[model samples]
Target: METMRAQELHSFYGKSPVIQGVSFDLEPGEFLALLGRNGVGKTTLLKSLMGLTDGCTGGLVFGESNLLSLSTSQRAKLGIAYIPQGREIIPGFTVRENILMGTFARVDGRREIPEYLFEMFPILREFIGRKGGDLSGGQQQQLAIARALAMDPKILILDEPTEGIQPNIVKQIEEAIIRLNRERGLGIILVEQNVPFARRACDRFMVLDKGRVVVSGHSKDLTDSVVEKHLTF
Candidate 1:
């Protein structure tokens, strides 16, 4: 597969296991919602797939390559872009500078944001001169995603994008995700606690209960009871 797949992925922080035999496959152009409560291994699974975990076991394969042996940069080079929780934008750099940082994997080091990027995110053009720290929370979230998009990744992993954003901006972000999946053929793995948002944005979803996949199927198959049981505290 040209997209991400995990077979019995397991990881731990110290002796306590976080991801316990978790497995899923993301198809090209598919939007997969990863739903779980706090500390359920959602972020840990993402890190493992991106090779950020120090002691991951089992198989995390991306496009025929086992990612356990690869470095984070190497995984990024293979086109897995992660926009972590809290929108990790560089506070000191200009918006353009932050976006430019995504080009580290590029063979040609270009400082300029490609014109094509503006087509995906026109608001970025207006913020080029603004410092990343000065942007509104919503705008900073957009910048974080745009920065990841600049990597031109085959797969985009977004962690709780709507967690702290305004509702209007969340709508826009959702639209952008739809465009990426439908028009651009980009596979998206989104980690979100918002059930409605997840159902709207993803075609398929997997629910994690204490680091185990408890419910998984097409999003169309989900019900209120399922969400309440698996996701609610």
Candidate 2:
């Protein structure tokens, strides 16, 4: 188990500041829901956590290491895997190849894709020979997660895992995310737009607006009134 903490963090895209004065913590095996309206810096905040932003400041620490000081690959080697919003599966690559790509982050040089990933999403094993681009949006999302899990990451940073997915498949993805956190004991930082689902699945929730965390509390505190004010369009 590993813990992630970010304090007074700021991130930029070229000259524009996207994340300002953001701070959070993810204890081992905890689930956090990062929520906000559209155009907020939620995506940028997730990217900052992964060192994918143009630049970042303040402290991002995991255990005793300062993540802000490390390169993206260096962070990955330390067991932080990012599943970005678009899924980002290599189009022409076979499902097996796509999953194997995550193994490069393993410092021990282990190349085996975990059998549990196949159990989580059996479609991945059935379509192991299929090209990544040939799968549906939901299947591709599951494959994206499989690719990340192949690295044996300690913390999973997910950016809108359910965006643009079909309704039925969305439930499956939600269940899988919850199972990954509760059963597998993986720390989760999820960016989600589904209010009820977020409340149901997350242990705690934070609401980000204009790059700053404006309202945050335990999942039980994320009432409908709070959602109406911060999350509604």
Candidate 3:
């Protein structure tokens, strides 16, 4: 298990800072929850990690490689998968088609969706022919994650995975995250505002306030007072 570090990260849009000097480390197979209120730069930080934004300073390093210089596809090829907010499934594509898109980064010219994806999200197998737009919101979220899993990523950045999802489906996704970390040894950076669920699923968490990391600690060490001041909106 190697260390994953985001070192002194800073980013801005149109001369206004969005992520202000954030730093964090993720141990391999660790589950970290990124907790913050809306528009506090959580998504912007995730996008910066993918190198989609123009002016992200500092570094996102995976082992020995610096991610800041890599293009989105290059980062994807290096095993960084981002499932951004809104699920973002192609509405016109079938479930199978959408999931297969995750394989676009493969270098060996593989044309098929990897076999491990079906094992991770069995429900996707059932919905193979179904249109992604026709699925329930929870189902769409599942497909989005399954699509990311197909990329064989070392680190998965999931933004607001439980937003607008039913409770039962949320539980399923949580359990799946636990299994992935425990069994496959994948690192997860979960961007979520759902405090209770995030605390339950992640080993550690960081609080982002006004584009900066205000506090961070293990989930078990996060007290009620800490939650009220930083997590409550």
Candidate 4:
């Protein structure tokens, strides 16, 4: 796993800056949660990491490579898997085909889906032939995660992964994320609304308000007052 460092990063969409001077570090095998109210540039920050933004400036280094210099596909090949909000799996593709798409970014040229993905998400195995559009929201989220895992990433970036999903499936997804970090030792940066889960699962927390980071510390320091001040809408 490689460390991702963003120094004074700024991202713009058609000259309007959404992420302003945001800086942070995601250490190897670390789980960092991005907590903020809606439209605080959390999603935009994630997009910037993947080079999906209209423009970005300042330093973004993943391992030894300068991420700002790399294309979106190049970033993926470098082991940063981004699962954006809305879980954008191809609607026409079958579960099997959708997952195989991720392998196209693999540097090793392996096209086969890893068996452990099935072990993590058995629902995908059961609905292997089903189109991505046919799956329920929760199942589609699982498929999105499974597809990302297929790329064999060193770091996983997720944007509100459990938002709008069923409660039961939310637990499953949360557990899977924890396992990916704790058991598999994959680094993670999760944008989340569920404060309790974020506090419980993440090693560190960063709170964004407007476009800048207002609070950040170890998970243990994420007190009720901090949430009430910055997170409570």
The most accurate candidate by TM-score is: 4
Model 4 regions more than 4 Å off: none
**Residue by residue across 8-27, what tens digits does model 2's lDDT show?**
99999998999999988899
- Per-model C-alpha RMSD: 1.6, 1.0, 1.6, 0.8
Q: Which candidate leads in lDDT?
A: 4
**Candidate with better lDDT, 1 vs 4:** 4
Model 1 deviation from native, Cα RMSD in Å: 1.6
> How far does residue 4 in candidate 4 sit from its true spot (Å)?
0.5
Which is the winner by TM-score between candidate 1 and candidate 2?
2
**Among all windows of ten consecutive residues in candidate 4, which has the lowest summed lDDT?**
1-10
> Which whole-number lDDT from 0 to 100 does residue 36 have in model 2?
97
Q: Native-vs-model 4 lDDT? A: 0.95
- Residue 50, model 3: lDDT of 88
Candidate 4 displacement at residue 63 in angstroms = 0.9
Candidate 1 per-residue lDDT over residues 2-119, each given as its tens digit: 8678888888777778889998989888899998889888998888788776577888888888888789998888888999988889989998999999887654555556676677
| Whole-model lDDT, model 1 | 0.85
Candidates sorted on lDDT, descending? 4, 2, 3, 1
Q: Would you list the rank order by TM-score, best first?
A: 4, 2, 1, 3
Question: If scored against the real structure, what TM-score would every candidate get?
Answer: 0.94, 0.97, 0.93, 0.98
State the C-alpha lDDT per candidate. 0.85, 0.92, 0.85, 0.95
lDDT of 3 by residue, 33-127 (tens): 98877778888888988887768888788888888877899988888889888989999999999988987766656668767667767788888
lDDT of 1 at 184: 86
User: Where in model 1 is the C-alpha error above 4 Å?
Assistant: 107-111
